[model samples]
Target chain A: DQQVKQNSPSLSVQEGRISILNCDYTNSMFDYFLWYKKYPAEGPTFLISISSIKDKNEDGRFTVFLNKSAKHLSLHIVPSQPGDSAVYFCAAQLKYNFNKFYFGSGTKLNVKP
Target chain B: DVKVTQSSRYLVKRTGEKVFLECVQDMDHENMFWYRQDPGLGLRLIYFSYDVKMKEKGDIPEGYSVSREKKERFSLILESASTNQTSMYLCASSPGGGFNEKLFFGSGTQLSVL
Candidate 1:
């Protein structure tokens, strides 16, 4: 079973537009959520994360919104740039400690210039 | 900054042969993990080691084993290569075992088994 699911396999957006990617989880115990970005041949890299205690976390042009009641999270990039094109994965952390992470299939985002 | 380095970016192996994939980290992370990435399956963990010589099987450890002799090194072993094992193998390291710790990944090793 997929504890975390990104439903959307791919998404495309125009430059300078808002690009939103969504993720959902079934496990309520997952308190910490993280986002990673991967290029075609590169490994994933940390993007942003949020704790269950907070509803939203923002860094620069990226913002992650957490809906605990809905068990859903979304990443928003304002003014999406062509360079932002990559596969985005959402992962969840069960315990506050230890590196047990569950990942989603990933959403491929394409930004058109 | 944490840096994870995989020994190979691309490899080709013959069926029934043995394969060893190596990973090294410069951050002295205590936790290291191995995962395979395939289309539709995403990234599934193969094995992980919290400390030297300690290993735990992850979701997909059927055809793989792991060895950790030093704090900075982790190795994934494929006892008998098979066509099904051809995929991108990724190695990651975290400062600690806590899920809160950010993971640093190597470039990845793409293996092709014939």
Candidate 2:
């Protein structure tokens, strides 16, 4: 069973528009959520993260929202650019198990310029 | 910046051959992991090591083995490579004793079993 799920396989948005990627988790034990971005021929890089204690966390143009009640989280990018097109993965971790992480299948975001 | 390095960017091995993928980290982190990425299945954890000579199996460890004789190096071994095992292999490292520590990943090694 997949603890983390990104139902959307792909997303398309126009440049300078808002792009939102969604993820859901089944396990309530997960207390931390993170987003990673991967480009062609490269490993994934950390984007942003949010703790379960807070509802939202923002960094520059990226914002991560966590809804503990629904076991859902989302990544929002404002004014999306062409360079932002890549595979985005949502990951979660249980507070007790810091070494293990659960990752989603990933969503490919395409920004049209 | 923490750097995780995988030995090869691409590898081709014959079926039933023994394959070894090497990974090393420069950050002196205590945790290392091996994962394989498939098109639709995403990333599946194969194995992880928290300390020298200690390893644990992850979500998917079948047909795979790991070795961590030293603190900075971790190796994934395929006892008998099969065509189905052909995928992108990634190595990651993270510091110990932290809650939700970020993982530093290598460039990944694409292994093809013919």
**Considering every candidate listed, which one attains the maximal TM-score?**
2
Clash count list over all predictions: 5, 0
Instruction: Encode model 2's per-residue lDDT on B1-114: one tens digit a residue.
Output: 999999999999999999999999998999999999998777789999999999999999999999999999999999999999999999999998799698888999999999
Q: Cα miss at B56, model 2 (Å)?
A: 0.5
| lDDT, candidates in the order shown | 0.93, 0.94
The positional error of residue A13 in candidate 2, measured at the CA in angstroms, is 0.8
Cα lDDT tens digits for candidate 1, B13-53: 99999999999999888999999998877788899999999
Which ranges in model 1 have alpha carbons more than 4 Å from their true place? B97-99
Q: For candidate 1, what is the lDDT?
A: 0.93
Per-residue lDDT of candidate 2, residues A59-90 (tens digit): 99999999999999999999899999999999
Residue clash pairs of candidate 1: A97-B98, A98-B97, A98-B98, A98-B99, A99-B97
For candidate 1, give fnat to 2 decimals.
0.66
